[model samples]
Target: MATALKTVQSSEAEEIAELVALSRAAQEQIAHYSQAQVDALIRAMVWAVAKPGVAEMIAQQTVDETQLGNYDGKYLKIFRKTRATLMDIIDDKSVGVIEEDPVRNIVKIAKPVGVIGALSPSTNPEATPVIKAISAVKGRNSIIVAPHPRAKLTNKLICDLMRAAIVKMGAPADIVLSIDIPSVEKTNELMRQCDRVLATGGSAMVTAAYSSGTPALGVGVGNAVITVDETADLDDAAEKIRLSKTLDLAASCSSDNAVILVDAIYDEMLAKLVGKGGLVLDDDQKAKLQGAIWVDGHINAKVVAQTPKFIGDYAGFAVPEGTQFFIVHETGAGPDHPFSGEKMTVTMAVYRAKDLDHAIDLTNRIQAYQGQGHSCGIYSRSDANIMKLAEATRTSRVMVNQPQSASNSGNLWNGMRQTFSLGCGSWGGNGTNNNITWRDLINETWVSKPLAVAKTLPSDEVLFGDVIAKLG
Candidate 1:
């Protein structure tokens, strides 16, 4: 991180062309590598980023350079995300003939896409790069990163560590590269030239990735909401909410944006949440907050990724001394009330539900207003309630009594795959409803073989036997 991101980076075309050429050359060396060699390459990358000193330095530098997210969280995030991603793909085969069925005489082969164009956001500069790099290498593909302008230095530092590991292992140093200077034009070109794209950013970046005339896996925004029912453990629920809403100042898209509590437990839940570092705001305070964070119908950028104290001060007030986040009682949902949408900070909108039916209905209305097909959460001991909530919501995932941010995208406790990007699945304008892992980076070649004898198809009369009897 010693060198400035754009000090003498030269022209945009030259930089993109240079990185693309180097990555293509590197892919040639990797495309023919065996599964063992690919695994060794990933091991080298995991080793490079998982070191204590290395993780600490990058985390500190990223926070210093971008002034976003917390140092401690970023440091831990590097290890957790990078190690989990590597573990997920460790034993998988990505080379030729990855699958075979002798009885069926069919085979499935894995082929590298050659090169991937990755777009990472400032919210998770270090972790995103590491995850994408590990994913690309697993499929024997090279990656070139286009980082956010605010986080370019951090991205370069991570890329430098990866390049060092590749070179030491006698692979092409260009297997993983980063743009020295980032801009819209350069990023668009990178998307157009690369064989595939993996985009993890805002709506604009995701839209651009899909429009680049290249195969791309782009993600959308997240406005996760958690529901606390009457039978839930208030203390445990409050603690989980606090942990997620305060993680790196709520930088992750999976961070809780709102909470809906059953009418039976509204008051008790609020009181317990206060003991867990939540500060409830009155209508007057909430009005002031509405003005402070919303500008031109959008959440102001100044309040994003900031602490509760900083946000309170910016809004011309003082938060309680131990306040970790703010909870405002909300009665409305739509464009007029910006709180109903994603805030990207340590603030949450709280709503009271008359019953389970009302809670599910309101949850859908909120999702329809913004952040559909992302995720939702529930905290209830009853199996019927959990299943009912899941069946009612249109979200991609329903986290039960788990921290929305930590476990939504694959965690140690949950079976979800580890990833930095969460696909919104059409509802949020994404193609897939997944955690966006290495599985999305490769193409499979299916080979068909002749069977010893062809089986006869069932007649329409046989297929319709049950229907015909019912009709008669």
Candidate 2:
């Protein structure tokens, strides 16, 4: 996430303290808003950015402002993610009684989680802030954004627009505040001071949020290893992979950084990928690729999330014109084979597998090296192949015939809840496997009445009677 933008606002302590207090006060007032009021507020805020030319303008500013990612993809990202997130919450009851069980005479009430500390990623600067703000407001909670220092202006623009919506709806503008300046110390203080933190950022920031001595939701890393089974349509699989890696120059952490292709279709799949604007690099070119992105056993931030052509040029070679991404043939796994790890750029490691079992094993090894519990994907017509990958791979979600970048977070085409923040399961050091949404933002209270008859378990002797008789 390194960039040339070095201007950081001073007074880190004063900025964070003021924002935190303002957000807390705003949440206290919003706590009393009715369910309808909360819903209206959320809807107004979502559409505020979705208006004509608004998203396109924000998308342009995001790329121009941060000097990271592409404008076209960011444009679509901000538009679709905002609309989808709001759609995901439109029907939900979050203010008062939300769930009830008549048989158990129980009621579940949803309450706001108070003030929220949000850390936005520079990769998807505009979209992350917008989606997180929507979720926070939907739960009747006020949010204070701690944006990536490189993209502070874009994040401020996002918050200012949403705050306008809040005030237009007769709510406090402080309901959605952002530190005018962003810094590490300020973000840390926001997490420490707020009621809860919603962290969507790099691994270090996430770890800090988790260790902030406050309740938080933090995400983990990704080096998605997708498998292309023999039964899969090579053309379709190639297209989907291309779509994911090319989106925002592969900004989404869920992008497929590695692919394990069954030997039966390996050659044909590579050809198909080449046909779809992918350049399969020779060994020498692969070395150049490695040198450009890996520096002293670490991923070089300079090449991360860069265009395929820019990456290839940076590596000292010219990628074919119109090349959407590049694939490097990899022979090993783990740290020794850096290609198997998350490249973050629009480059992937291609592995050949002997059969179905071998493919699953390869996927596991690659994921273990980096993206353990984030996600893996499989493209096949056979249910057995899909299920096999699901059971064998240590991934939080397994996408089937779906583009990883588009489907991993959430999309209208799949059942995955629409979200901007995807939680990597325990394997990825996150609390929940479900995509972060409005559900994660609210607190639940349970009220129950006694049952008509007392409930108790059978005695051990009665449960063991049949077994004892048989044994005797």
Candidate 3:
């Protein structure tokens, strides 16, 4: 029986290897396409967005397969990509030819970056693939995606759909490709050999991509922290925090992991949060959830999504049944208090600060503990307070009066490139990714030169002489 099992596993492994080889071959073929052909591939992807139920079905299937998030929220992300992000790239000057000025004699042009190797995460499997695919096409690049091991089937199906869409739109047949088996070894080989790589997920994978000796665009982990000052509207802040935390069961990296409250309004804010279905766990409940929160040094997904009663029971607390979320109060912020860190599950740590400045200080501490350079939030009308926190946090995204998840992930106000994967910036203390965007996958070289004006001044003379004189 042992020998037979080994044989069966070996056979399966060989099949996966073949699939990876086929994908690589297809990517090579796609690399040979002309600029127009690449543009056609992008146009097909743009048109694919209009297909009824495609995005919705992809999102729902991913949630069902991964069991990590809510289908409704994932559906919204799909629609956002299809209707909003896709349109944003249409007719955008990222691809195609450029004409130079006759006098200036400078020509700016966009060129296709050959083949891209991308790694997608299970948390947002389908959305990540679609975002990468659409962006690659927009940049006139062919791509090969390596889905998370847990999301292989979903990734394969989505890749096929995208390829079919591109071919139907008169582009090359293999414009988008993926492998059925995404082993660490195979993925490492692809990343090292591919023209460029885009990695989205944990710190380990992003670090690997960066060290793969090829240009890589990677996204880091998020541990978003929100601060509520005494002068703020506690009711509105509570609602937004609830909305942000509960969205898709807090699977998003941008989900609010910690809440920093000013001492004057901590009780009031806690009251509103509890009123809005936030379960405050007692000491016994905290112990019960502690096991569920951490297992063998990592956060367990199953326990985090469990009901408050389940978590309480797991932590040794006797409580009512059907508790969906929990809130733990903490006096200070540090790694010793894991609750005060990024709890990806439906749990949050609330800290009380002395004043507005104290709240900012706590927020900084929380970021230092785990968040790093990702995103932070503040619920305040005081412009001074907002600016102060914004400057102090030094996070990539600082949201004001909105849920951190949506705001930090690419909602209208955040000004971040729209995508599920976010670059945690320099503050996350990780050097892998700067930010997540389609442009990050492609290489850009300006094809231009100085204008050849008939009556040009000498090299020492500035173009804007009068403007330069004003400065002097």
Candidate 4:
């Protein structure tokens, strides 16, 4: 049995090598493509998946295959995510000379990073591949996707559509590919052989990518903690929080895992949340939920992205028919209190804070324990409080008065670069602090030209007179 397993592993590695080689060859064909040519290819690929009937088909199929997330939510992501991502990069130049600074005597040119190995998550399989594909091609780079096993079929379907579109544009179909059978060994092999890795999955996978001896960018673990102060509009806050918490059954890492409410308006906010179909669980139900959602300090796979009725039933409790989500009152943050971490379902933990300072402290503690460097949201009208939280916390994105899940990854209403991958910077053990997109897949070269005339540097006295005077 050991020998057979070794042989299978060797074969999978060889298969991945072949895929990488093919991707490299296809990428070479377009490595010198003009900006117009690359842009046209991107449009074709987006249209292939974002078209009306196609988006709905893949969305339904993804739900049927993964048994995660609802159909309507997946459909919306598929229909809008691809096009919106395109819009974000449509006007940007990714070819030849991309930027020039005459005053600095420098010119920046963009170049592709060869073949990119993209590891996609099961939760957003329908739109992630398409977004990554277009983004990769925007830099004239090819990509090979290693999708989650649960969503491999969905990934293949989208890849096929994009490949067909690429062929229709008279480009090489191998530019976009997927691993029909994905495993740890195969993915590692692909990452080792590719020029770069774009990992969008669990912490373990991201760690592996970083260790694969190739340059990689990975997203951090998401346990987004949001705060609602007395100054916020309770009704708007409640509605947006409810929307973010329950969207796609809370599959997004940016979903509100814990809400810190200021003492002055705690009761009013809870009432508003209750009005939005949130059922505040009693002590007994909360205990049952804790037991069902977490298994030995890890999230239960059976509850992830599942409906409220399904989760309640699994916990040996029954929620009311109209309950869209569950709210549990909690006073702690950390391992001892499992509710402080990410739930990945339609359950949110609610906390009470004495004021804005206390609320910011709670948010920082909760994020430090789980979602450090990822993101957080604030529903406040006070610029001072917003800036205070922004300065106090070590988060990459601090959204204001917006649904985090909808706004963190970009939406029609926000300026965030539309992307499925959110880099958590060094704080989250990732490299960047920006939303990962087409701009991340390219290499830039700086060309320096001599200035017409040279100038002497300023004297130390002129530069530091104020400091010298203070010392005197």
User: Who wins the lDDT comparison?
Assistant: 4
lDDT string, candidate 1, 254-341, tens digits: 8999899999999999888888888888888888888888887777778888878888988977798889889988867888778888
Q: Is candidate 2 or candidate 4 better by lDDT?
A: 4
Q: Tell me the whole-model lDDT of each prediction, alpha carbons only.
A: 0.88, 0.87, 0.72, 0.93
Residues 352-374, candidate 2: write the lDDT tens digits: 99998998888888878888899
**For candidate 3, what is the lDDT?**
0.72
Quote each prediction's TM-score. 0.95, 0.95, 0.83, 0.98
The total number of steric clashes, by the backbone 3 Å criterion, in model 3 comes to: 10
Q: Which tens-of-lDDT digit does each residue in 325-428 have in candidate 3? A: 67888767675788877777878888888898887778777778877778888999899999998887768778889888877656655555666656766665
Question: Candidates ranked by TM-score, best first?
Answer: 4, 2, 1, 3
C-alpha-based local distance difference test score of model 4: 0.93
Clash numbers, per candidate: 0, 0, 10, 0
Show pairs that collide, candidate 3.
Answer: 104-451, 104-452, 287-315, 288-314, 288-315, 288-316, 289-315, 308-323, 373-427, 373-428
- Tens digits of per-residue lDDT, candidate 4, 1-472, equal 9999999988988898899989999999999999999999999999999898998999899999999989988988999888999999989999999999998899999999999999999889999999999999999999999999999999999999999999999899999999988888898888898999999998889999999999998999998989998889989999999999988999888889999999999999999999999999999999999999999888898999999999999999988988999999998888988899999999899999999899888988888889999999899999998999999998999999999998999998999999999999888999998899988999999999998676678998998979988997
Error of 1 at 22 (Å): 1.2
Q: lDDT at 93 for candidate 4?
A: 95
